[model samples]
Target chain A: MTAFIGEFNCKLDEKGRLSIPSKLRAQFPEAVGNTLVVNRGFEKCLVLYTKEDWLDETAKLNAVDDFMSPDIRRFKRIFTNGANLVQIDGAQRILVPKKLLEYAELTAEVILVANGNKIELWDQAIYESELNVDAAEMSQLAQLFHQQRNQG
Target chain B: MTAFIGEFNCKLDEKGRLSIPSKLRAQFPEAVGNTLVVNRGFEKCLVLYTKEDWLDETAKLNAVDDFMSPDIRRFKRIFTNGANLVQIDGAQRILVPKKLLEYAELTAEVILVANGNKIELWDQAIYESELNVDAAEMSQLAQLFHQQRNQG
Candidate 1:
């Protein structure tokens, strides 16, 4: 598996549409996908997953034995309730559903980050803040990502 | 940061050079990254991180406070001890250090998997086995990743 890599700065137009950089879009492996699923990410950012990856993720979420487990339910609901099928148009742009745009607090400018399995869309300032880490704050970040990843 | 995506079937040449697929290479924002760090990943695979991502990963690993913590020590050692600075050649191939090849049990054939922050190099068969996840294994995977991440 080749991870999608690199970061790109982009914009959200007045209609909440985003133009995924062609540089980024061109890496899609047809076997894993060209289709995409947009949904809430672990953090405030929005996550975009290839359709194939989405199925793998959904399968994991589906493995939760207790459907009534609050963590499982909340996690599933947050993901599925907000999940939207999307595509980059001929112009290499994708329309961010109004709810998704709001979920990520995206304004005019945004940063599209490629994390291993998905893409995280963050408010530019927030994205910058997240990456500007220093040594002393290490432990704090450890706790932060831990809590965030487990927030369910 | 871009999460690496897609699975690629590749090989470790007699000289131990791994040719990163052109498709994946095309995703890099730069003509070629100035630096790369190859290290031991939590799984039985070798991880290749762009210098920028390695810095972020190091920041997280640096959070471990107790040198006496065996788990933390082992995790840190795996990453640091195996970490090697490498360059991708003009032909878009990287020389896999002999030690790393042995560490990941790479034979003539291998697979490069794109993970969010890094590329995982695995012996082809091992990679396939690792990916054959079943429902009962989901919780186990969740636990394994949690423990691995917390070790730092």
Candidate 2:
């Protein structure tokens, strides 16, 4: 498992294809082979995972004990059923399904991709507007990470 | 908004109550006054957000035009319907629904709270298994962020 961290901004072409950063692309060679799973992320972003990772994730979701709970049924319906397996073309691009593109508010224009353990794609304006990071808290964030690194 | 970034280890009692870090508590004054939303996050973690943020997020999901395609229906069912909103107690603790805890593979012992734009509560072992940083790709990730940050 590799840590996929950082942020990226790029264009989604007319056909809805966006390039995966080369570095990140290298991490998925095994499971992706050719196709990757792209799905809705928590915020206004898209999440991409290799086929194997997707299967592993969905298996867990499927293993939920009871479908009686609305949450479990809903989780199965949305996360599991709503996923799309797309292939990365020669240009390192994957076609963004129309529905997913709309969900993330991404157009053919600029898109922002943030690296978490998962990849999150967002519309440039919405990403900036929704991300409420404040300069005043920079030191606190830095300190927190510093402490974690020290503890680790 | 106060940035709550880092890792904090805490216990989720038998009753499903876990203490919120003081640093994170300071960032969600409104949530303290009312309720917050906790939902399933990617990477076997639970995501916590203020009511305002949750509403904003769900509204977007709700707006997905299900009439457009089968994918829309799937998205609506999973992302929107699976979500749960819980109120925080005076002690800054919220009950983790048994189902959600099970999804994240949490037990009575320890949980790891990680800071992203939102907080992710993860089982300690799962967090340890999932936390692998790729030092070899740091420069590439940095370059991507640099390019994106520099543009506009």
Candidate No. with top lDDT: 1
- Residue pairs in clash, model 2: A78-B78
Worst lDDT run of 10 residues, candidate 1 chain B, spans B66-75
TM-score, structure 2 vs. true: 0.44
- For all predictions, the C-alpha RMSD in Å is 16.4, 21.7
- Assess every candidate by TM-score: 0.49, 0.44
**Model 1 over residues B1-152: C-alpha lDDT tens digits?**
75678789997789998888999887776833745768766667998888777767756655553223433433333344445656789888888777678868998888888878678888988888988989879988899999989996
Candidate 1 segments exceeding 4 Å error: A32-34, A67-71, A139-152, B1-152
**Once all C-alphas are superposed, what RMSD does model 1 give against the true structure?**
16.4
Interface RMSD in Å per candidate, to 1 decimal? Answer: 11.8, 17.9
The best candidate in terms of DockQ: 1
Error of model 2, residue B12, in angstroms? 0.7
Model 2 error, position A103 (Å): 39
